[model samples]
Target: MRNYGVVIPAFNASGTIAETLLSVAAQTVRPELVVIVDDGSTDDLASAISGTELPIHLLRQANSGPGSATTRGIAALSTPLIATLDADDLWLPNKMERQIAHLERFPTTSGVFCHWRNFRNDRPDAPEAEAVPGWSRTTMMIRREVAETVGPIVDPPGGRGEMIDWIARVREAGLALDMLDEVLARRRIRPGSLSYGRDPARDRGYLQVARLAMLRRARDKAGSG
Candidate 1:
């Protein structure tokens, strides 16, 4: 079995899937396994992978939502460590090498999330910025065991914010998390991207995440009080 695995939940990512996998494939510590889950993509995404030189595991399922697709990928883990890269993001060449070193020092830590530049273009020198105040899902290197122990990824309706809920759950369960100072990933922002793009429907995703957080807070308080 490979020492590391990657899971990319893609839906209609015909434009970005190739570059995304290429970025991971170019890593200094290449992932031992690469799993791309097609969430009912109605595009040439399958054809795109057919041309790639990289050997990756492919799985197709109905359009159950991005979160659900990610859940399926998580369920397929067969390595001790797993990394996640979206079909639209790029990983810095040394992203994996550095994150793995961090894990070496913090063996008790369940995952490590690094900082990333958010850019809207493909320019290698494109000026970019990280999420202000904190890091988000764009940067993550997780241990497979930790993810399994926390329960599978939830296929919640809040496609974008499902990560926040999942991480919150992991933290509340006493799993240690480490943040690296290096910018390990590049987030490509397009006009129709779920989190950064215009969306009246996506607004509800945030609300759902916030509501869940509030409920968790209340439960924590009640337990303490």
Candidate 2:
């Protein structure tokens, strides 16, 4: 079994933190270390997750946005392979196990991602079997070094679509990315979420990042020798 590390970056996620942690603890291929970057949550998220039975690493930072929080979580990882999930998202039973098996089978493939289902908050929903237009962080795993080498999801407050930036960078670096024909994650679509909220500004930020990702891809492909 591959000793894996799972990173979760959260802020003011007390409402969903416990459920997320429970889902992680229940995974059939549990992570050796699960680190939660509590980005200055105002609630008792730290206290709630701290006493869990599973081995967990919690880091507190001064609300630096998801990009910075995710970077810190990645830096703290000790395993060669790292998987990430958001506080509002959840994984099916064998999410990591299947991803790890695929990686081990295809050594040249630097990243593996599976299709994810959209859930209404914690309520379960059926998986979207088809591949989406682009990759999302909810269903992805990659080598630790490779992820950092390609560049992580920075440029935050990238709002709803920041993941596109990182995914494009990995492919731009010429690392093969493949998708598994299975569903292993449930992406929460809560109405109050920053992405789904009333703030049009957040949506505009998301659009900017999405555009930036496409631009980066074009540049990288053009630059390819």
Best by lDDT: 1
Number of the top TM-score candidate: 1
lDDT of 1 by residue, 1-225 (tens): 127888899989988888888888788887777888999999988887776666688999998777677778877878888888788888889988988888887788888888777777566468465443224555777888777778766655546677877888889889998888777788887877775765657667777878888999999999999
Q: Taking the tens digit of each residue's C-alpha lDDT, what string does model 2 give over 1-225?
A: 388898898988888878877878888887889888988888888777866777888999997777678878889988988888788888788888899999999989898899776767757555444534226666878888776686656754635556766776777678899998787777777887764556776666667877777787687689894
lDDT of 2: 0.78
Per-residue lDDT, model 2, residue 187, is 76
TM-score of each model, in listed order? 0.91, 0.87
- The local distance difference test score of each candidate is 0.78, 0.78
**Over 4 Å off in model 2, which ranges?**
125-134, 197-199, 214-225
Candidate 2 matches the true fold with a TM-score of 0.87
RMSD (Å) of each candidate, 1 decimal: 2.2, 2.8
